[model samples]
Target: MLKAMVLRNIKLYFKDKGMFFTSLITPAILLVLYATFLGNVYRDSFTSNLPDGFSLSQKLIDGTVGAQLISSILAVSCVTVPFCSNMLMVQDKITGARKDLTISPVSSAVLSGSYFLGAAVSSLLVCFTALALCLGYVRTIGWFFSGKDILLLSADIVLLVLFGTALSSMVHFFLSTQGQISAVGTLVSAGYGFLCGAYMPISSFGSGLQKVLSFLPSTYMTSLVRNHAMRGALAQMEADGVPKVFVDATRESLDCTVEFAGKTVTIPAMYAYVGGMVLVLLGAYLAVQYLAERKRIYS
Candidate 1:
């Protein structure tokens, strides 16, 4: 029954062509923007601080920029895409479908799990497609990633998708109307990239702003993706004789490692932080679901 419900929700999400494509709008816009001029901007930022008489390969710079672009798109899409995918729950509510489903013998837990699992699966489908395209683009520019990099990135995307799904479920539970979801989606799509240091590095901000952004789990998520995506490029830079100091500085400036309270956050710490937030958010959603169900029964 749970599997059927999950499949049904997935079908509903894809069957709505507008909603399906709309989920990709933010990533699409970022891709276009990056291709047009943002690519050069990032490249320039990366090379602007080179020491006197030092030069790096244009190929290396392009590869690094491509890697950063991949990280940015993945980070932003992890949240925005799931926001659209999870609209299934809102659609159910607005159409009276959820009430009808509840009247069936299916347990509320199974029905709710269907929504979460369906959204997570749908988000994974979209994000994985984006990852493939990004990898292809990087290859055309200058491929630096190893097979292991690809594997780790795939794992990171799965973790991020789960986090995004739980977050969307929690947020959408309170939204009973299309307008509410639309408004919130717009707000997130427009601002989430900046907040999470996807469009810009947190290090570029003032110390106060950087400190504030550090508290956001999405910031760490972005760092995790950036670290893996750029690992090969950074390694290549080191192999090509770039000074260690410069490479470390680049890592910090590009948010390959996030800093909290003047301390660098290690990769494992990032995973722990994001994973903890996922559990917290999912638990919160389940608690809310229980409360809502109880109220419905008593009222």
Candidate 2:
């Protein structure tokens, strides 16, 4: 049943060639543009402001870390994944497909799991393709270590996709119409991404805004990117001519931080941030399911 549902979804997704291209190709294009245009800007920004002693050259050379952060950011905050996921749900709702599923022999768990699985696959493709584009651009412009960082980055991308899928599930539940869903999804996602340090540091915002940003899932998504990419980059910086004070200062200035895999990870505090969201989403799913079942029985 799960297989059938997944296959059906894959077919439907491809049948709409426009949607397929928009979902997969748009992000890759954006990543290429950002890496090509902003890569150097970030490099320059890092170099110019890199307090008095750090090796800006090595940080730039750490293309793996940069690619990871950029790719993950593009995947999580850009609204493409959430937009697509919400659209799928809205389509199902509008056509009465979701209502049909509610009455079908297939369990609710299977129905929800199938949709989440399809979204996960779609998101994974976007993230991988975006990273590849970023990596190619990174090679052209900077010094990036492509070995361990690549593996770590790939793991980070997978986690971000999972986090995105879980998040979209809750969004899918609340929206009553496609237009409303799309508008809210885009605005909320883009706003959170920007405010969560995906494109810039959340700390750059006023303190109140930063505190609110801390609750957002994207904050942790950025944290995962930082831990995966910038952790090594920072370690390398410390080894190079960067002063301890400057390195410490840079770490302190980070928007979020985490400790994972027996290492003290400093990026954005992505784990705690996403964990909170996941818990909330799980609770929402349960409440919706209970209400749905109760309505079905009582009515």
Candidate 3:
């Protein structure tokens, strides 16, 4: 029964053409823009910013383009995964399916697990697909993740997906209508990239704005992935005679690192940030779920 419930939601997500396509639209558009135009723009930025005699290498091309790809993926995944997950729950609420499920032999725990599992699986599915396609495009431009990098990226993605699922559970508790869901989807898809600094580098913003964006979990997530994604380029730049100071400048200018309370956040700190956010979100989601279950049982 648990397996069936999980499969049902996953199936519904795909079967509903509107939901399926809507979830992917922003990612597809962003991937195209990044792969085609932004990659060239970043490459040009490198050429223009560095010393006159600096020579380019494969890793330089990889770093400039790879940073954008990593940030873009993290931004889209953070929003889309949770949004799609909650949409499924909201659909169940509106259609009375959840009420039916509540009355079945399945316990509240199983039902909740199913919904989460369905969302995580589906969200991961779409994200993985997007990742593969984007990586394929970047590979042609001389940027590719090494095997070790892929494993690290995969772990980061799974954590983000889980965090997204937990967040969706909390949000879905409030979303009782399709209109509300649609409004959220439209707004997030249109604005999250900019908000998350995927469309633009946070480093370019004023210090005040940078501080504000740092509070967002997306900021840390992007920073974490961008470091792993662009580290090779840094090495390449160093090898090619670009000073470490200049490479650090490139990272700073690109929003690949963030500052908090006058200190630069490190990789370990970024991981801590993500981990802390997940715990807080999961706790809130559980509290809301318990309250909702209580109300449903009595009402």
The most accurate candidate by TM-score is 1
Candidate 1 lDDT, 1-299, residue by residue in tens:
99999999999999999879987665777777886778988888778888778898888989998999989999889888999999999999999999999889988888888999999999999999888878988999989999999999998999999999999999999999989988999898888889999888898899888888889998999998999999999999999999999999999898997878888889999999999999999989988998888888899
Backbone clashes, candidate 1 = 0
Best by lDDT: 1
Alpha carbon lDDT of each predicted model: 0.90, 0.63, 0.75
Off by over 4 Å in 1: none
Tell me the TM-score of each prediction against the true structure.
0.98, 0.81, 0.91
For 1-299, candidate 3 gives per-residue lDDT tens digits of 88998999899998987777766665677777776777777767767787667667765565566656755766566557568755888898899988888888987777777877888888888877777776676676666457777677677778778777877777777888989898877776677777777777788787889889888988877776677667666666777788888888888877666888878888888888888998898778767777778888899
Better candidate by lDDT, 1 or 2: 1
TM-score rank, highest first?
1, 3, 2
Clashes in model 1: which pairs? none
Q: Rank the candidates by lDDT, best first.
A: 1, 3, 2
* TM accuracy, model 3: 0.91
Worst 10 residues of 3 by lDDT: 58-67
TM-score of 1: 0.98
The runs of at least 3 residues in candidate 3 whose Cα sits more than 4 Å from the true structure, single-residue gaps closed, are none
Model 2 ranges off by over 4 Å: 51-72, 75-80, 254-273
In model 2, pairs of residues that clash are 61-143, 61-144, 63-144, 220-270, 223-268, 256-268, 256-269, 257-269
